[model samples]
Target: MISQSAGKIFLAEERGHNELNWFRSFNTFNFGSFYNEHKHPFESLYILNEDTLAGNRKISMLAENDSCIVLIPVVGAISFKDSAGNSGLLQAGQAQVLNVYAGTTLEISNPYEEESVNFLQIWIKTPDLQSTVPQLFEFDLDKNPNQLLELFSPQKKTLVKTVPQPHGVIGKFSGRSEAVYNPAQSGNALFAYVIEGNVEVQYRLMNPRDGLGLWDLEEMELEALSENAIVLILEIPVLKTV
Candidate 1:
């Protein structure tokens, strides 16, 4: 068990947005060329990048070590092939998790020639920084609307197969309603990202693609302010050393 206190909020507009010829990315925490020492990883919760790619455009693959990366498609689809000879397609209703140890390279591309695809890529740091063999897991998002659905739970091996766990809980909230979040791990922090429509966290309004990070609280209230609003919430440790 960890110490719990009042939670703080990190606004979305304060983040960095970078637009390029092939990709447009928004960084919730310092990433790529948008570096901010203060806005670095939130405890073990490292990176959250919202990206949009032009159809048929390929973003050069990623080479990382000892990191758990999750990709969720929002608007379209993406085709990916990893150095480990794993390949798959991620659509709007699906999500993918990549566990990289030691080191691995991954290539992602938009398959459709006329439609653009938008996705979110999140990185969570593990306790042990040592590298391991790369593995990929893709799962379909729960279709439950107007409620919170657990997408990934670190202790639940049946959810996804990987090491280190990250010791976090990731969920998807759909429809317009109020939901209470109780961290599976006491003293953990919460990071909520609005996928579509509007949502309010602790009385603070968040629009599409907006994000808020809360910590030190036993529970937090989340309200979907508009129809079809979708929010992704991640509960991670508040201590940086975790």
Candidate 2:
């Protein structure tokens, strides 16, 4: 029998380092001062951050000209103002995608005066790094309650199908549900993060904020272990591009 720790990447609750007063971030891979050369990035997926910002406080992040960024609010709301003049408000169940070509800077702050906000910041290096055009997208996930919904993809195709390219996929799983996740290609990778509640991913249980990265598999089965359980999955290419 394969142990729960075997052939799987299990990032426990305390493995992520915390920042100072304004931001508390957990690095799925080496990020910021949390440097681990061996843990720099996974394929095309570079950064995965679980961040909490104090009310009225803000944080700034720089994106390379050709990389892509996706932000999902988990608790409270955040107001994002970027160098491209793309500013908007996003609350829980809402997501924002930024195609940061030609270099971009983003400032994110908690809009509420008394409420702190927690959100996930993910970065993926795309094949279109030389493109100078930048685009921003915002969408809500309230349409589907218990099923896995695709929030963003390279081709912007339907929920289950993604273009077989060096791309990234964002999915949200809600309620006590079960689903099979098939990668866009045979040797791709999938990284799952439990946003809220508990879930048994491929027979291993994961709690809130726990992250698991799986590869070398044909398919994955996800079962929500609790009511209203919500998880986020990121699918990416097995090879990182320029």
Across residues 97-120, which tens digit of lDDT does each residue of candidate 1 receive? Answer: 666653667778999997889988
List, residue by residue over 154-179, the lDDT tens digit for candidate 2: 53332233333333333455556787
Q: Which stretches of candidate 1 lie over 4 Å from their true place?
A: 1-5, 61-65, 129-143, 155-176, 238-242
Residue 51 lDDT, candidate 1, scale 0-100: 83
- lDDT against the true structure, per candidate, is 0.69, 0.70
Cα misplacement distance, residue 131 of candidate 1 (Å): 11
Pick the lDDT winner: 2
Q: How many clashes (backbone N, Cα, C below 3 Å) per candidate?
A: 4, 2
Q: Model 2 compared with the native: what TM-score? A: 0.80
Cα TM-score per model: 0.80, 0.80
